[model samples]
Target chain A: MKLTDAKAQFISSWGAFGTHWGINRTMAQIHALLLISPDPITQDDIMEQLSISRGNVNMNTRDLIDWGLVERVLIPGERKEFFTAEKDIWKVATQIIKERKKRELDPMLKLLSQLEQIEGDKKDKDVKQFVDTIAGIRKFGGQADKVLDVMIKADENWFLGSLLKFFK
Target chain B: MKLTDAKAQFISSWGAFGTHWGINRTMAQIHALLLISPDPITQDDIMEQLSISRGNVNMNTRDLIDWGLVERVLIPGERKEFFTAEKDIWKVATQIIKERKKRELDPMLKLLSQLEQIEGDKKDKDVKQFVDTIAGIRKFGGQADKVLDVMIKADENWFLGSLLKFFK
Candidate 1:
């Protein structure tokens, strides 16, 4: 419960959780440090707290900013850039979902669409079989996308109210 | 958009995403394959479809079963385990969250608690400072855990209702 012990433990656990969510360990740890600080924290302070090298800190900070989960803070008289995490956990989760869909989901959708145009499958049994196989996957992927879209855009109370519908 | 091109692209993108997700490449590809199949697929079929070694197919299939994302469905009168994915995307997401929390969150919580109990300076300035820093992190981690607990309880309607409230 002591302050110093608390800081180290926070950094360590945040780092471990990062890998599970497809993030680098150190990146999440730095975010953890920023989350609890009452005021903006400078890069120099971060380096000292986490005991990481300058380059590693710089790269991961950039990544966190890119993910829209952390932001730079400007102190009126301060020269060094300070950082803080996005405080609303729900918003943080939303930003992550949107970004991942844009980066990962959209591309897969485009690829699946393009595959539907392939020809020559009727001329060869093997080619036909391969095409059939891919068509199936494309169908599944599209369905999955629709499911994500539906979950995201469905009316308020959709998740709880429709639980029985899905079960049936 | 040729079927050939589409299949190739799907395999590659899915595999890349899997690496980020800690599922590795071949394992994800195999999962992708099974997800779309109209018929029950055997281990030999998986190996051929994935173009992976028999051992790779054997290992990843076991992993899929372990994760509860994929199941070894038995044929009516056959010996080989026919594989299939849990096609419900909601169920898929839930399983992933549960397994990941077990692998990443639970262990980190224990570690953080252990690190928090480490004794430090009661009177020394630096000792007091260090301990306070770690404590701040532990508090943040606890807050994060609270958010995740609510998320674990969420279903479709719960997600939508919460998002609507938060959005407004």
Candidate 2:
């Protein structure tokens, strides 16, 4: 495949993948474009390349920055803001994991804790089942929380090496 | 909280959580309902409880079954088919991991492999960056594939015990 064709394919596929994971398609495509670029790009460049509106680019870029996966880059004597994505895939993965843990898992765990305290007789089948389910989910979420904490803090070499060894 | 109110809250939250992760709200709500039910429930029961149409219940239940998180249960003398979710939270988690790995992660890795073969001069900065990004993602995806494989096959006690020790 030619480089340009390959790049287009990657961007398109990443967008589709993002939709499956609850992210907007245009946002993922912009991220994909930035990921493969050798230099930081302006919003105008992104708009032209992705064929998206300026407002769309503006919104998605802000979200990407919020996720800590992309950053604003300043160019000397340049009026327009430029953006760049973190190129290291490991760091990218860790950043996503960290944010999702905070946004989704932590909240779910809190809800489970509250649900576990529902007033009911333990002998009732409905009560027993509810408590058991909540407790099980809470325990699993707690374990995942700890595991992700370690991962977000560890460097690539130590984390992957230890994981490879342990899993092996 | 009363048992009914607690159940309502759990169902609502689970549905909301599912939307964040790209699962449909109705499907997750049905799964949540089945998870906490001590006995198998019929499609009509699900429709009445969740205030959804019969078609919606049928469609989402089929999807849940496809994901291996829920199953059809036949009562000996009943004419209607009943459904039940895999109530073991550990098993539910592993099943989802397994299905997503097969559906999404595996295909992504395959695409990355092909993208890695894009023809380009290595000295060109764009080509170099593209190749590097693809290669980095492939390596990380490969590692995750292996880890998820083990997790899918592992029993809960052993897997969680090992992960806790390893991460600690």
Candidate 3:
């Protein structure tokens, strides 16, 4: 396959993959472009390559940076910032997981704690049931958080390598 | 907290969690409701409990069924279909992963294969580079799919047990 066609295919597929994984399409394409590029690509390059507007590129780039998936690069004799993505696929996935957990799980853990503390209405079966369920979900989420912690640590090949053996 | 208040909180939070995980809000909330209920909930119950329109309830319920997270339950002497969720949290998570893989990964795999078959423009550096990058992603995604396949088979306590050994 020709390089240009391959690049387009890669970008489009990666963007679609991103949407499925809960990231926006454009954001994923930007990351994919940066990921495979030999050099840091400027906003103009990304815009030209992806046929996206400046604002869309800027917003998604910031989001990618926030997620620890991409980084900005400075070119000598150039005023515009260039960007590159984390090349290690595992690290990219790990960072996405870690950041999402921090954003989604931490606050949930706190809220569950608060909900558990609320006094149930003894006369109200519905209220009692609701509290009990929240309390249960909190317990479950706590365990899931532990699993997340384990997965994060397992980013090292040692854990996966050992585990991959058992799958056999 | 009162039961009504607690129910509202749980639904809202679960819906929020769903958004992060690529599941729509109403679908997740409905599942959350079913998870906590002592009895199989009817369509009316779901619509009422969620305060959603009938069309919204029908659509998301179908979606949940398609995802294999929720199922129809028949109550004696009742023709109306009732709904229930997989109670075991581990099983619930496993089904989610399996369904998501089919929805997201399967399509990308096909697309990657088609794109890879595109005739190469050997003379163009750009085309050559692009093809190589996408082919690399195809390799990466294929490996990911294999890893996920192994995990999906380790249902419920089997997962925890395997993960225990994997992380050991």
Highest lDDT scorer: 2
> Which digits, one per residue and each the tens of the lDDT, describe model 1 over residues A1-168?
566566666667777777767888999898878765656788898999888899989999999999998899898988899998875544555577667777777786686666656776467654564556556555655665665565445435667447523322
Alpha carbon lDDT of residue A132, candidate 1?
Answer: 60
How much lDDT does each candidate structure score? 0.70, 0.91, 0.77
Task: Show model 1 residue runs off by greater than 4 Å.
Answer: A116-168, B73-82, B87-94, B97-168
Candidate ranking (DockQ, best to worst):
2, 3, 1
How many backbone clashes does every candidate have? 23, 0, 9
Candidate 1 residue B119 Cα shift, in angstroms, is 12
Instruction: Rank all candidate structures by their TM-score, best first, as comma-separated numbers.
Output: 2, 3, 1
Tens digits of per-residue lDDT, candidate 2, A27-124, equal 89999999999999999999999998999999999999999999999999999999999998878988999898989999999999999999989999
Error of 1 at A6 (Å): 2.3
What are the interface RMSDs of all the models? 8.2, 3.1, 4.5
lDDT of 2 at B157: 63
Q: What DockQ would you assign to candidate 3? A: 0.38
